[model samples]
Target: MDPKTALPLNTSRNMPILGLGTWQLKDDTAGTIAAALELGYRLIDTAVDYGTQPGIGEGIRRSGVERSDFYLVTKVEETDDAYEATRAYLGELGLDYADLMLIHRPPSSGPGEDLWRGLIKAKEDGLTRDIGVSNYSTDRIDRLIDATGEVPAVNQIEWSPFGYSDDMLRYGREKNMVIQAYSPLTRGKRLDDTTLGEIAGKHGKSPAQVLIRWNLQRGTAAVPKANQRAHLEENIDVFDFELSEDDMARLDGLNERFSSLGRLPYA
Candidate 1:
């Protein structure tokens, strides 16, 4: 496996760094996912709320790839009965175990700890190989670890050139948690940024590609969503090229306080 292309999930195994995000890739999700698999995308990101689990499973089946070869991930949305609800929902996906599972959002209720404990149990029961949390604040992660005596294997957050959070990233690293970036493209807000455009010009790549490479260089696993076939292919074609130290520094200078989507503190 490619060293830069893989990430270690706790002490278990390495997961692919680039994954196909299925946030809004419905309707033709199965076909698209199948195409992505054929095109060599081994990591897939989905959520129970995405309503495409069945299609994802169908795509995986049709791809003719061994289940063990893919790194499958899904998230459980915050709900009053997140434990039982997530258990039932994942059961419907028909997978024996997921490579990674995360709480979609930090729970507002006091039972957030209970939900995490349930996920830990799921890991022990072989329902998931690794368990994590998404959109969690630094305080929340510290508190949970204190409460459960377990640190999350990963922490998925909205990260991009414009929305980089040094504090959260530092904390995750301090806890030995993998930081997975969900919107590494900044939702296309910085596609036309002058700095990225210049970097792309020098490298003969797209601005999006440059941004994705920036994420990789920063040591964060990124999953950028694209429903179009060409876009999907373009997103994963980032591995062939390498960014220079100067180029990386230029891109690093593009970091702003928050995403163009506005800052929403972790709940």
Candidate 2:
């Protein structure tokens, strides 16, 4: 349960299990990131569309932490050339290469075989240490593998106990793709639910901590967004205790495909 604990990738690299998700993080991005890094958070998630890339670069500089000490993930728009987009994102991040790069979504017309190929080339040229996809179905990933013969190192999705299903975990285990869980805290939308409240009261933990711990115990990476100091500390302080079998089963039963981002296409 160490803060820096990570899961392995198909590319033989380790991706941190817990991270800071910067979905709409724009104001004071540098300050928030700098604080997180100093507090032992090593994995950071952002996207080109988030417009926080420059701020992230500045945060890393402000933290006085070595660039290699943390894992950075960014996404490319599915329309642009993945390789060029990766290069451009690198510049915006002020880093030579990102730890991981992802296709933000699958192509509208097809499975994005060509875009996947571009990511393969980017990995070869070291624009990113590993390549992945976000918001992709398992079937779409299969098509990418069939066309390129390369499996994605990670598949990020909006996953939480409320939106849970065993399908993605089974496929991820079968293919060695880490399922990075975004919005693992449910965006604070369902934190006040009675079930979550009961569980939190039993464990003497906040509902948010329970949600994150569930992700970690299930073996997928969790990324919960937070900019405030108290919230950040609470998010990372989930390692001291473990949820029991009953707790896990009850949590699993709460799944109803809930998602603040609307219905996920994942199956």
Candidate 3:
């Protein structure tokens, strides 16, 4: 039940399901990233918009861990120069290539297909090992496939028991795209929910752990963030426990079609 064990990313390799989310995590980036690496987290998610790449880089350097041992992911923010910008940023981060690179969000100002072309190029040129989209809708996904003739390797979305989207998940699965759940803890809104609390009580765990376990059971990879050392440790501790089928059903019943952000056309 070691969390470091990577799950099947298809048959060729595995990806660690539980990862460290780097949103709004900066200033103490090196220290925090180093600490998390020391704590046994192999997957780290960051983005250009987060303004923490330098810190992440510093952390990685300080951690003294070999780059090949970690699954490093970053994103290209929606900007006029997304491709070049991402390349420059990664240069600053001092990594030759990222394990995964995503389109941070559907561009609001330009052709998403054009931006995707840049991502495809990055993948082809080996700047990124895998390229994908984030915050994309099913329609957007279809258009992307039509343009690129290849589905994204991963589609990161906001998924939680509170706001489950079976349609999106099903579509991503059909395409062999990994469904990565961001904000899987519901941004602290559902930590005190009666049902989640009940499940936590039964398992002697926290509500956050219950939610993460639910995501793992559903076969979705999750990146849950926590700045506190204790909280970070607690987040990855779910691998040792397995929820019962009945408990899984009860948690599944808690889906309310809720969304922290109003339903946007894109993810």
Q: Could you give candidate 2's per-residue lDDT for residues 9-87 as a string of tens digits?
A: 9877999999999987776999999999999999999999999999999999999999789999999897989999999
Residues 57-154, candidate 3: write the lDDT tens digits. Answer: 98999999998888888888777365686688788688988888888888776438877888888877878878777888888888888987867878
The lDDT of model 3 is 0.82
Instruction: Spell out the clash pairs found in candidate 1.
Output: none
Model 3 lowest lDDT segment of ten: 5-14
Model 2 quality (TM-score): 0.98
Candidate number with the higher TM-score (1 or 3): 3
Candidate 1 C-alpha lDDT tens digits along 174-206: 777888888788888779988888889888899
lDDT comparison, 1 vs 3, better candidate: 3
> Per-residue error at 104 for model 2, in Å?
0.7
Name the best candidate (by TM-score): 2
Ranking by TM-score: 2, 3, 1
CA lDDT, every prediction?
A: 0.80, 0.92, 0.82
Model 2: per-residue Cα lDDT at residue 160: 88
- Each prediction's total of clashing residue pairs, residues at least 3 apart in sequence or on different chains, is 0, 0, 1
